[model samples]
Target: MVDPDDVQFIDEMPHTATGKIQKTALRDMFADYAFPA
Candidate 1:
């Protein structure tokens, strides 16, 4: 199970003009996420 506090919620997934999921953008958004020690 994951901790609720550590989860990041987004209004929607970022997409490209062609309607593809923007994986790079998604990764960058959570790049600063910190895990429990």
Candidate 2:
């Protein structure tokens, strides 16, 4: 789970030509998820 308030919104998600998130994927990959407060 993640905190709704802490959830960061981005205008565009970085991805390769394959439609897979590239740069943004790393952020999510190593992100520390926590339950919503």
Candidate 3:
């Protein structure tokens, strides 16, 4: 389960050649992300 307030929206997602989510790219993208207190 996840919380809506803690979600981040983006226009696109990074994926790998195997058609899997690329966490490395996500990390780079959300490097400065802040979570709700």
Candidate 4:
């Protein structure tokens, strides 16, 4: 099951110069996220 608390709603995803979603950059940005207990 998915946890709502763990979901992050961004205005828009990060993109590269070529206009492709930067998965690595996105992951790095949220790599330290901590879910509430």
Highest-scoring model, lDDT: 1
Model 3 reaches what TM-score against the true structure? 0.64
Encode model 1's per-residue lDDT on 1-37: one tens digit a residue. 9646666679999999999999999999988888777
Q: Which of 1 and 4 is the better model by lDDT?
A: 1
Per-residue lDDT of model 2, residues 1-37, tens digit only: 8645666567777889998879778677648866467
Worst ten in a row by lDDT for model 4:
2-11
Task: Rank the candidate models, highest TM-score first.
Answer: 1, 3, 4, 2
Stronger candidate by TM-score (1 vs 3)? 1
Which ranges in model 3 have alpha carbons more than 4 Å from their true place? 1-5
lDDT of each: 0.89, 0.72, 0.88, 0.88
| True lDDT of residue 5, candidate 3 | 75
Q: What is the C-alpha RMSD of each candidate to the true structure, in Å?
A: 3.1, 5.4, 2.2, 2.4
Most accurate candidate by TM-score = 1
What's the true lDDT of residue 10 in model 4? Answer: 91
TM-score of predicted model 1?
0.66
Better of 1 and 4 by TM-score: 1
lDDT of 3 by residue, 1-37 (tens): 9658777789988989999999999999989988879
Candidate 1 segments exceeding 4 Å error: 1-7
Select the stronger candidate by lDDT from 2 and 3: 3
Which regions of candidate 2 fall more than 4 Å away from where they truly are?
Answer: 1-5, 23-37
